[model samples]
Target: MSKNPDTATQSSSGVPPLNPADQKRRDAASTLGNASQSKSSPEGVKEGGELPKGWEWKTIPDLVTDDGVFIDGDWVESKDQDPNGDVRLIQLADVGDGVYRNRSDRFMTKAKAHALHCTLLKDGDVLIARMPDPLGRACIFPGDKRLSVTVVDVAIVRSGNGEFDHRWLACFVNAHPFRSAISGLQAGSTRKRISRGNLATIPLPVPPLPEQRRIVAEIEKQFTRLEAGVAALQRVQANLKRYRAAVLKAACEGRLVPTEAELPRRSGVPPLGSAKKRQDAASTFETGEALLARILTERRQNWLARRSHGEGGKARGQYKEPAAPDTTNLPTIPNGWTWANGEQLFSWSSGAGLTQQDIQEGNYPVYGGNGVTGYHNAFVAEIPTLIIGRVGALCGNVYLTDGPAWITDNAIYAIQTPSCVAMRFIRLAFTRAELNKRAAGSGQPFVNQRMLNETVIPLPPLAEQTRIVAEVERRLSVVEELESVVSANLQRATRLRNSILQKAFTGGLR
Candidate 1:
């Protein structure tokens, strides 16, 4: 995007513009050097956000004492052939400090270099790309010896000095207003570009001598801290995401629970046990009946709660908890176990419906098909509950609640019988379970209370259920740690990357 202007002469070939007030300060600063400051102090802060009295404010051009401007070089295209040349080539990769540092994987020959004489590199020279998204990004030449490469889509700004600091000037070019103005001038199709001539037009806020060094230091220090924090947050987010996935994986694997109890040592599947064993276990288990009774009682209460408090929804169906013993559905039961539907373990209720007036910006999390969408004043389920999305994008998505919630009409609540099942266990099961898939519908899937209540799930003993939940949590912790370590490393790498940029930008290194 460099303007193809031939500037082998030492004239200000374009604008004849210069601010007189700035010219006066430049003249004044040249005479005083850096002696104007507070007594018995290293330096003083700018007065009322002002630079020290004698400190001059100048554009980039005035700082350089070179006879000719940066445009005093030829502009040419790069080589088309790969070379076995002895000099390292500098590309956009090397033009980072607004100068070339020779980062190309290959070098160019003296013949190739002379053929493509875009711009020549000199000590204290600045190079800025005038193309793509990195337009206006300038780098300073910390000249030693490096290979010269094809200068494709790049502009070089040079100075011969005992004059300006390369590090200080690079930072100034990268600072706010200058970079912004350059980017704003970019115009093209498919690829964006700003002419090198346009880059020369970029305005800069050049504070004199000691002040430039101070501002660069301050900006570097603040940016270093910010880069560190951004790195840490990214690491934490990665760790948390991995941890959550681990938790789910362990829950499904069933390793989280303690497997302290030994199973019966059997050779092959044992022949059918005596019927009397089943009868005895059934008769002795009061829990089987009591848990079921409580669920039915709660289901009735939930129905009443819905009728009283819920916004009048569709009169779909009113389903009671399933009757306790259905021997037809089960041929056998485990010791002290019973076969039952989900209806006997929870109270099902549809979420509330409210017009815009009834809704208020409030504290309660409102559950809908899209998860929590608003703070609601009124509520749906009053206990620890499981909510399933009943419509729209997140249909079949399930969420577990810790307490009372205000939910939208597109979800249904399943409040577990207080003593029967652990709420967390049920929520985990729902996450893995296929509930909506069983519901029959075409356009929008619907799990009416009847279908939901009657859904059958394997009912392990209550004590076993608690054990399973504990095991899931225990196993999840290890997976969580693994994820945390990966995340932390990612964060560290990010911080190091930014540190490289900061060091290079702030004169910490070449």
Candidate 2:
């Protein structure tokens, strides 16, 4: 216990013993000295290097003030923090495209925050994420009332002098070329991260003080207008969705077109002489009920012929009559409309399995739950078929194909449709139904053929169905046109934003 302190630290290799704490302090001082020298000396800028007149090139660390701090965030676990804790914890998710997102739900106790010695963020401080959705995206911190600390991997930057503008620096950090440089310096195989040393070494284009202010002012001015346009675009997109849903709702209610009952009844009597002429006159305005009866007769005849030929012998003993849909609580329809189960109008079957190896590039489209997944040389379903998603998040989505296509097992395909029913009308009915509400699983939502077949649909007369389809298409076409314009303008706005940033850094923005 009373041994000499020097002997306690002696090395077996005879090397001189060093104090660990003293060595750490010396290393820190050396680093700061190198940064200070690099900041003050123009020699750091290579001879004949590219720089605008009156502008200079410097490492990021050089431009920072000697007292300015560069530090990562706290490493506290989520379980240790309280929901209503006194200190807010800034996370990588709380940073967005050049703006601070105040949507964080994490918080820490004030005592715990102080114990960790976390950096207290200030207004106008710059924060950048070391990791990426996009790496190196920077935003200025908007100071808040509550005590705040950021998570590890988020770098906090503070300006040391009046020579640099924080806003301009953030914008430059998000610029394309600067991002490319960051990408090159990134480490790690899967989750890429930029080390603090590498971040400090990044080159920054130092504009004159007055120019930096002007650039920031101009960027904000342009961004205000661009954001207004984006807001308007979003409103239009939301309106389009509502309009589509409204159209489908109206079509299903038989209010989208003139019903047979709305049409003028035949005033003049049919010719008294010919029975054939009278029969033709009576058949002119066939109601949905009359049409259903005819369709059922045709289906029975077809079934009888198939049975005689043994065409579907495998299904002979497995057949079970589908129960009619309960319509006691259903809404009233027009004179020529009726509520009927989907199975009464169409036959549903699951799609056969087709692997990726079975896909062959050709004109025939192969459809999965979300829509066309690939192409194949052969098709399984005929033209004018309806496909419904049967599994996963996309379950209950519906599609109609006008040409032959392959339907993959992730969806259910309509193999038969009664002539009296318009497939387009059926598609609209399904959309209004919102079948996803009936999905059966917690992890992977799914719908079976029985569920869809049992769902009730309001059927309109043949003539009225045709008119409804035409009107819906005409209205949706206009919506589609407006959507295209809005989409194009949004894209243009993005390009313009990038162009402004490019010009600001390249001396093109005067």
Candidate 3:
């Protein structure tokens, strides 16, 4: 919401009063030179840069018409808003760098607009966001199909057919150099902002009227091409996401590599037509059920060992077996593949909590529900361990530690995974399952050891698990490399944008 400006400046004729600091910065620029040129730097006029022959340095107030308005928007509180009213309430979100975002949908009645004295917006008026995230990003206001007024945090500039171009001013404000200068003037410890008073003081680069049009056009032409390239790169990223999903689906489905059952047939084993032939082939390979049994046995022994050492907290009187998955309506798996509940594959436990003070510069990485929340001196889980996000929005997210790590209370880790299983295979399986969708609560969703213990997933033979992990890694590695290239080019595009702006203002556009 915004606060109304003084009644005297409500119409275009009056200029808003400047604060002492604003007045000082404003006076400093003019006192430095009049009609004198300096070399232009990426940081703009503040850096003492030279301008072209016809160009001159001017403050925001010097560029606008005597009748033009430069003021902050009215402070309309949420309580004053009416959703069905006729006047639209523009917000900081609606101001984009050199573009109109039109992201807010707030409105108030025409009567309310008059009562609050909110400045009504026009088509070509420039709106500047005063808050940081690169403060002082300005954009032309494209009218809401209805009447509109912006929030107090946004400064409105109405040139009212002045000697200068509003579009040029918006472009100048968005330039890298201008934003860099504005950043230093921003205040507020919690959320940085540039006051309307301070905003009025920044020195602006003004070119001859005709040159301004040419510079704006050339910048847009290059930007249009850059945007198209970025769009293409984004499409490739989207397709790669689809491709990654396909690879995971195929790997889990026994299609990515030869099945353990089929591999034997390829290696001179008898074809499986008769039951006797199938039995002979099956006996040669270890089945998923057999592998799971070995894992469960190892987990039981570890628990017993911990209990004997008085380490396993709140030990039960008796040892309980891992639960079997309910596979009633599940899809059929290839021969040698079996379904196992989560607990049958690995032992799950909550991680120890580590405070921010305890997390320090160390060799061990500290992990929370999200990966690598910080670094710590001690590790709670060894390298190659499977971790699952246990709480909040990230609950059910899975990650595999590359090195010894400290798992925080916000996540759970596999306390014991049999050496026979491939951790990579488990990570891929959990990812494909989209475990977050099964998380429990609407707010602060969580997955306890009990919840994970009961979740069912398909399991392949130990040998097949190794093959799947290797193949998936190979394909994903290629995707990762291409992603790196795309990422680099995206960064390159940003540099090019800034380069164009720097040239446009410094007379390098020609």
lDDT scores in order = 0.55, 0.74, 0.78
lDDT score for residue 167 of model 1 = 66
lDDT of 3 at 344: 83
On lDDT, the stronger of 1 and 2 is 2
**What's each prediction's TM-score?**
0.42, 0.78, 0.86
- Candidate whose TM-score is highest: 3
Clashes of 1: 14
Q: Name the weakest run of 10 consecutive residues (lDDT summed) in model 1.
A: 38-47
Clashes of each: 14, 0, 11
Misplaced by over 4 Å in model 3 are 1-49, 267-283, 312-314, 355-357, 391-395, 439-451
* TM-score: model 1 vs. ground truth: 0.42
Task: Indicate whether candidate 2 or candidate 3 has the larger lDDT.
Answer: 3
TM-score of 3: 0.86
Ranking by TM-score: 3, 2, 1
lDDT of 3 by residue, 1-510 (tens): 222233334223232443456544444334323322453432323343656787876666666665677878889999889999999999888898788987888999999899998889999898989985558899999776898998988888887656777788889889876676666567789999887755655566688888888888888888899999999999999998899999999988889999888877677663332122125535466678777777787878877887888875645467888768889988888887888878787778899988787787898988899888888778988757889999989788899998799999999998778777888888999888788888888868988888788777778987799999999999999999999999999999999898888778777888
